[model samples]
Target: MVDADQTFVIVGGGLAGAKAAETLRAEGFTGRVILICDERDHPYERPALSKGYLLGKEERDSLFVHEPAWYARHDIELHLGQTVAAIDRAARTVRFGEDGTVVRYDKLLLATGAEPRRLDVPGTDLAGVHHLRRLTHAERLRGVLAALGRDNGHLVVAGAGWIGLEVAAAAREYGAEVTVVEPAPTPLHGVLGPELGELFTELHREHGVRLHFGVRLTEIVGQDGAVLAARTDDGEEHPAHSVLVAIGAAPRTALAEAAGLELADPAHGGGIAVDERLRTSDPDIHAAGDVASFPHALFGTRLRVEHWANALNGGPAAARAMLGRDVVHDRVPYFFTDQYDLGMEYSGWAPPGSYDEVVIRGDAGRREFIAFWVRQGRVLAGMNVNVWDVTDTVQRLIRSRAQVDTEALADPHVPLDSLVP
Candidate 1:
């Protein structure tokens, strides 16, 4: 074991990095831990940025993972407003910014996280076109929405991922006229399969939001340096006062690549390659969160998930591995989104093209239901819409790897609790 004074350096002060620092302390490692964040604030929650926070229903302080005092109380060094310029793995140090302040680490965690993927289409640089990845971006969008007087404000959300839908819901709640444009046939088609995808599409449309599917955006039209509309590939121009680009995120792996770490397949989408224990090819450097791709037991392929739960759970798992603890990092991945009076929760892993049966447990038409994606008599994944209790039972079933009865799962008369392992 290394000396207690051995320094631990964590890059990126987002959810994963912050949690890793907290976990290191919790694991009784009284080491010299330094958290380097590009932003000025202490780590704050990002999920709420597109939802309650953006709507002004939540304060900035409320989003903080821990208060500014907590970091001090824990005695964790906070290096704010410093971007890691390069990682010198051979030298066991990281150079930050132009001044090149070097931080030496015995062990390093690359929780560099991800950045919003921008569209290369014309007029993307328009003033009103924005991406909601960071708190600042959300703040800017919120300010514009509030200034425009949400009521009857025309807002076009280009992309139909969780971020896009959540932002669209918030804009609608403020009485904005919202239009969601998605290139896919259904929103969340890549994540949620067809049956659940159809449910989400219907859910958004029911809430008075216009939904356009199977159409690609060609350009963001501008007037006087501000966005005016979005031109589609189908030769359609949809007018809007503001536009949000929520086309998903690309892993922030530049520093890792610079350090000569093995990168995962771009088809797996530019995440760092790591073993089950979250150890990167370098072994001394570990990666987790959206930046790391590991083999999934359920999917049987290397996968990367950009969910809040992964950062929450995986950060601690990596810390344990660093401490030489035998910890299996397998758990049901979970994510939730609140949109249009619907609380959507999903858990477990969905193998691609493996769900042969979809069993609905509640009324989809009533905007409340749990849909189970079953393959080979086992529950691979499940989607819950306003039926959160079912998620607990699904987690248990997934952990136990239990065979689920299709008829019982589909039967609304049966309690989901009855299916628990």
Candidate 2:
């Protein structure tokens, strides 16, 4: 029999929620664990959706984070296709959709995650304009890709972020002419910084993907209920048969906000406020993944990190905390993106206006390089492009908070581990 007192309710069936449930069970909580997901399907991996999955390189079954039989064997009650209408913090209950069923919980984890930001421009609602976030979105894009004739189709992608670049690469692989429009001066400028962003721009260009930087899109033009082109702020129209809006993502925190949970400052966008323990204002409720903005031990500020590592790690951390374990979330932020034939891995935390020097290792021209961000002679962040082993060295350097010799770090002759203190 399940322990009634250990009933844990998890909202949202993404990586965070599913992992949290798994962690709870692994921690010997043989209790009632209920996972509520608004989506009809079981929790699945999302990172591949924008890359291999979109290109039809991977099957839908491979995207699942956990198999149905696994959940059943673990005794996890999955409530799929059920919307959480509201959360009653005081009563420790969650109300669902029109059915008005209320489920009470001793502890609750809100892994609501985030939704892809959509283009609000004209013709955005047209048939060929889409945003890549969910399985449904990928299915639609796959359908469109399959229906295209042998002639190369024009695909206009809004925003030059990782998703946009990945989709562009996939589209190009399918013999489609891809155009990426970004208001920023360079692709991934907001995340990768200018020098690295320039490298990414070159990589995309090398793949025959047209990139329009420092250009704001004014509207998405469609004809006869199908997207035809995207109009820029410069009064230029780029013809396109399909448009993928991969601008960014917004945290899904409406239910959390309505439940009277304190939210993060809007100046930092719509992320939910949480402590180092991933506990929200209400002690009974906790949050993880993209929806959460928690204090960074290294950066000395709060941040909302939207990365696969964060979702995978943060979920279990929150679950452990909910199970009366006192644990501080202090992992250095890490993420990676694959574009064309290049793979980029980044590690550590970089506080704004703090890095004093950036040391590059290996040759950028040869499609292999690692850049280290240093502040006060201490390594703060590192980016490795096409060099997988650099990630191991970077992780250790970040954890040790070591000061690296710039000369050794910048020298291609020296191995990355030699720079680690």
Candidate 3:
């Protein structure tokens, strides 16, 4: 039984850490809870930063996970704008803040999350260069988008991933010209493969966004400390008043590394290696969210997911395991994206080469369809675009691992639930 004498410390103030703290209290744990965050703001969700909030459709206050007063009411020690300098595993203590104040813990949860990958090319430090990973970045970008639209300025975006595409859509809505540069043949080539990635290319092109496929931004050219244009490897220069780097993120695991915790292989996307219970090699410590790489029994591979759904669910699962409850962090990978008029939700993992074929069930041109990635007649992953209320059925099909007929899977008349058997 967890007693009041025990103190649980949580590092990193992202969604995962915030939810873990909430779960501990809801589970009737009387122990002391300390939540430490390097950011001054309360724990908030990141999806809004790229989607609604960035587009000005959502207010700033909506980003927070909970009301500011909730932490105080729950007797949780909320330390904002503080950093954990080091973790002394043997002493069960963490040296935090600039003063090096030490705080001991019976159990510790690291939800350090990930940081945006930086652009290494010259002129990246120019006035209009931007990267969106935090609320502050979103706030600045939000204003920049409006100003660009008013001035009819051009915005060059690097990468055509979710962040890049979403921001491209937002920039277009703001009436700013957009030029996206990607090394892949199509947008989202890594996640959706060439087939589905082509659809995104058409979507953005229809919205008046220029896409430079099969090329990368070699350098961001600038004049007078302000962005002037983005030079591509093809010897083409796309005029730009601003540049947004959306190349993806790297998991933050420095603390876990310094503490001597076992880490996952780099080939598998380096992260703190954890078991089914989200517990690290050191039994007293656990890692969740983007920082954790756990073996997925269903997929039969160790995976690290940076999606919002993982953090939303993983935190609670980690907390349950901390309370000595039977828990397995084997939830299927899931993610969603909103770009222009198209909205999509993808469940299960079927990165390129994992599936032998993609079975589509609706009109592709209309942008209302369900695509399933199947291998050996078993569904490996599924994505529904502009389709609603079918996520549960799709996930059930993935978990069942049952042989599904490609003909029936692609038939709109065939109900998805009936194919499970």
Q: Please tell me which predicted candidate would have the highest lDDT against the true structure.
A: 3
What is the C-alpha lDDT profile of model 3 across 211-301, one tens digit per residue? Answer: 9988878899888999998999899999999999999889999999989999999888889999999999999999999999999999999
lDDT of candidate 2 over 1-421, digit per residue (tens):
2364668999999999999999999989987999999999899988888878988889999998898899999999999999899998888899989599999998999999999887767788888888888998888887676554246688999999888888888888777888899999898887767767899888888888899988877888887898788999888899899988888999999999999899998666568899999999998789999999999877777889888899999999999999889888878889887777888889987644668877888888887888888888788888988987667778888777777778877888877777566
Candidate 3: C-alpha lDDT: 0.94
TM-score for all predictions? 0.96, 0.96, 0.99
lDDT by candidate, in order shown: 0.85, 0.86, 0.94
Q: Candidate 1 lDDT, tens digit per residue, 152-225?
A: 67888989989999988888777788889999888888878676788778878887889999998888888789
Candidate 1 RMSD computed on C-alpha atoms after optimal superposition onto the true structure: 1.5
Candidate order by TM-score, decreasing, is 3, 1, 2
Off by more than 4 A, model 1: 149-151
Candidate 2: residue 285 lDDT (0-100): 89
Model 2: weakest 10-residue lDDT segment is 143-152
Candidate 2 clashing pairs, residues 3+ apart or interchain: none
lDDT of model 2, residue 344 = 83
Using TM-score as the measure, which candidate wins? 3
Count of clashing pairs, candidate 3: 0
